[model samples]
Target: MLKIGITGGIGAGKSIVCRLFALLGVPVYDADTRAKWVMHHDKALKQELTEAFGPEAYTEAGELNRIYLASVAFHDPQKLELLNSLVHPHVGNDFTKWVEANQQAPYVLKEAALLFESGSWEQLDEIIVVAAPLDIRIKRTLQRDPHRTRHDVEAIIAKQLEEEEKIARAQHIIYNDDQQLLIPQVLQLHKLLLSKI
Candidate 1:
């Protein structure tokens, strides 16, 4: 089965594109969500995270204390890298196991916000980037997450790779600015991927 990595900057609509892919019968693995699962349940990962970030990594209920870690990691690049170094390996291993079990899929889509940053792109046959104008992306993020100020949303976007860099690396691009029709783009790619196999 083909393994495709789907990535985009914050509010570029990666999840929406992945949802369209899922509707077309692709097995979509959401790396961010799965990382949360692993942080809570993966023994080695939980231990490593606790060691790196201290006991505050998990609450008394044994669930990850995301608020605490986010404050520590997001403000410091080195701390973020350390966290990824520990978690990405486990997420990669988990993804491999998922592929082994879903061998019948036409193609498996791995949706990750940090596909390139985590080096997970090496695991995929192709990469798809969903693109939108920066202003639109900012607006979308603000609307979806009103709890975050525009500055907070923009800061998050600033941390992700530039759209141009991602575009250069992408094998496919989905313009999801709500200006172009997405279904046609998706249907076209469906045929293109089948030809690859």
Candidate 2:
């Protein structure tokens, strides 16, 4: 089975493109959602996180305390890196098992917001970057994610690879700005990927 790594910066429409792929019958593993699940459900990880971040990592209901974790982790770059260090290996292992279970598919997608940043692109056969103009991206994100302030959204964009760099690295690019027709672009890529081995 061919593995495709699909990524884009926050508010870059990566999830929309992934949805289009799924509509075309490609399987997609949403790494961000799975990572959150692993954080709450992985017992060993829970123990390690508690040790690293203290018992506040979980609430009285045993749910992961994301706000508390982020408060400490995001402020301390080293802590954030350490948290990712603990989580990513488990996510990688989980993806491997998921791929093994779906060996019948011609191709599968791993949709992640941080695919390139975490170097997970090396594990895939191709990278699909969904992109848009920076201002459009910020507007889309602010509209879609009401909880994030404009500055909060901009800070995320500032941390990611520049649009040109991501575009240069991608084997495929899906333009998701208001300027393009999304379905036709999706269908074209669908046909193209199906033609490949």
Candidate 3:
């Protein structure tokens, strides 16, 4: 089975494209969702997180304290790197197991926000970078996440791999700008990927 990576900047509509693929019966391993699950369920990883980020990493009920972790890590580059270092290996191992289970797929998508930054792109055969104009992206993000201000969205974008670099490294690109029809682009890309295998 081919391992494909799908990535893009914040609010670039990676999830929308992945949803289109999912409707076509493609198996998608959502790294961000799975990372949250791992941090909550993986005992060793939970212990490691507490050690690294303090007891507040988890709540009294043992749920992952997302707000605290974000506040601690998001503002500091070193803290963010440390958090990724602790979390990503566990997420990677989980992805390997997930891929094993979905081996019958023609191609599996590993959708990650930090595909390049976390160095997970090395495991994929190809990458698809979703693109949208910066203003559109920020607007979409603000709409989707009511709690986030424009500055918050921009800060997240600033931390991600540059758009030009992601495009240059990608094997495929899907333009998610509102002016274009997303369904057709996704369908065509789907057919193209299936043809390759």
Q: On residues 151-194, what C-alpha lDDT tens digit does candidate 3 reach at each position? A: 89889999999999999999999999888999999899889989
Q: Model 3 scores what on Cα lDDT? A: 0.95
> How well does each candidate superpose onto the true structure, as a TM-score?
0.98, 0.96, 0.98
Q: Give the TM-score of candidate 3.
A: 0.98
**Candidate 1: C-alpha lDDT:** 0.93
RMSD of each: 0.8, 1.1, 0.8
Global lDDT scores for all candidate models: 0.93, 0.89, 0.95
Q: 85, model 3: CA deviation in Å?
A: 0.6
Error of 2 at 193 (Å): 1.3
Over 81-179, each residue of candidate 1 has an lDDT whose tens digit, in order, gives 899899999999999999998899888999999999889999999999999999999999999998999999978987899999999999999998989
Give the local distance difference test score of model 2. 0.89
lDDT of 1 at 20: 86
Clashes of 2: 0
Preferred candidate (lDDT higher): 1 or 2: 1
lDDT for each residue of candidate 2 in 137-192, tens digit (9 for 90 to 100): 89989999999999988878876888888889999999888899889998998888
